[model samples]
Target: MSNQDQELLIELQGQIDQLLESHELQDLTSWPTEGELDTLIAVEQGQAFHITLQRDPLPSIPLTVLQSSSVLQIKHMIRLQLEKMEKNKGRHRRISWKYIWRSYCLMFDHTKLSDDNAVVSQLGIKQDSVLRFSRLAHAKGHHRKAWRHR
Candidate 1:
């Protein structure tokens, strides 16, 4: 990446970090302590490979890293997850996710999720977890709700 791009990435990362601090739901035990970051440990087949953050964009983070990071916020995770799914599905569109849970699917006020600092472990989600995506909701935070339950 160019110097300008790198600087932009750093700034963006910092911004996101601040957002996580303010908006993420926290799981005290797993949350990032001090300077701890969301890091990636790569694997090859069934064997360990290397640890990496790959200098990738915030929206394109590796899932393994994301899953383990206690500091990474859910709102960001939702965006990355939706992006991952879109790539896997061979779609070239940016989108939001929504879930169907509790009695044939119910719409919810997800504005509260942004304020949660709960870590991924506390959130009970993982890479490749099957869920639905939606562009249905125009409200904040409900843009992409990872539907953990069916």
Candidate 2:
């Protein structure tokens, strides 16, 4: 490896060592199957997995992310990947992250992942899991009218 790559690797190793020595990982024996610390260790060990993101009219997008990543982080990744795909196709569309979170619900295994702070592993999202996003009915500018009708 080049000198710069070697230096980067050493820096990463130091950070991993620091994290491994942190108080949260002290009780390895008590680590739960879906715990954040376990996911962190898996990420450090290069055990990240690929998940499929699907929405109607668009082909499924395969994304690889660390198991400890939060729903919010995954949303950000999805935005980035979408933008990249658009750019590759000679389009320049900028997706609003805030609007996305406000206007859509991401579902996994028929359950809405309502908590943005929830970790992927904790939500039971595993390798090959299919996450689907759908627009929220209330966010489509019909809530006021629907409420008035009610």
Candidate 3:
């Protein structure tokens, strides 16, 4: 492996060790139809990954995952899904980038999610909802002087 790749691997292992200390392994009770690997976050590594455990095919049912999970968790899942899809097509994957939700005229208040920690039942996001998150726009407050000068 290249020197950079080796360095990244070491960094990832260190972060994983820290996360493992705080979070418990997911069980069926916590996550029904639990996957072999509890979806995990490696913040320092900027990666999220999981392995399926069930004998059944990986179900794409949003409700199953969203109902018991927090909105923040759903965001992670969406990132994970996108990462998997892009990787399959031979693209790079990283989940650390900022995001801004968009759909028509919908206003997304980042500080106040529809239900940040509530179950999806409370969120009311429809089945097959396709959330569109683009790169977050840079804050506009600081550039007012340039506009006034113009």
Candidate 4:
């Protein structure tokens, strides 16, 4: 990667980290404690596995994340993968991640992974599982309502 690309990645990572920290703080009731996450990660140290994120028109993105990782964390990983993919394609434009998150839901086997705090294993997401993005009801300029993902 070029020096410029490396710098862009670092900047984007920092922004995403800040966004996640603030998001966790906003949802304090569902957010896991650092110690708890550390313990879980330690227990699942050797259980990291790969999963694919598919969005048509773009090549499938393969990511390796811990089974104990939260859905939000998986989204963070996805954002990073997207950045890398763009860099590989020589496109340096910034992505509107906040907009994308608000407009799309990640689905596995047609089931929406709606709980940001839910762990991958809890959502039945295992090795080689494929997740796709689906537009939310309020993806466009419409009144958003509480829609349950069953």
Task: Give the number of the best model, judged by lDDT.
Answer: 4
Q: Of models 2 and 4, which has the larger lDDT?
A: 4
By TM-score, highest first, what's the ranking? 4, 2, 3, 1
Clash-forming residue pairs, model 4: none
Each prediction's Cα RMSD? 16.6, 11.4, 14.5, 14.8
Clashes of each: 10, 0, 1, 0
Q: Backbone clash tally for model 4?
A: 0
lDDT of 2 by residue, 1-150 (tens): 999999999999888777667786763433234544555566557777778999778799877678788998898778877986998799997767776777788999988888989999899998888999966666465574332534
Ranking by lDDT: 4, 2, 3, 1
lDDT of 1 by residue, 1-150 (tens): 899999999999898667566633232223454422323212223222121222223332333334433422433554565565778889978343332211121111221222234454444444433222222434575554555866
Displacement of residue 2 (Cα, Å) in model 4 is 32
Off by over 4 Å in 3: 1-64, 93-96, 99-115, 129-150
Question: What's the TM-score of every candidate structure?
Answer: 0.25, 0.60, 0.36, 0.62
Residue range 1-150, candidate 3, lDDT tens digits = 999999999999888665555535332233223242432223113333222212124434221243455666766665665676678689886644342343111112232354456654455444344333323343577432332534
1-150 in candidate 4: lDDT tens per residue?
999999999999888667657744443224456844553454456666778999898789887778789999989988987886788789998888987999898999999988899998888988789999988774366776777879
Candidate 1 local lDDT, residue 51: 19
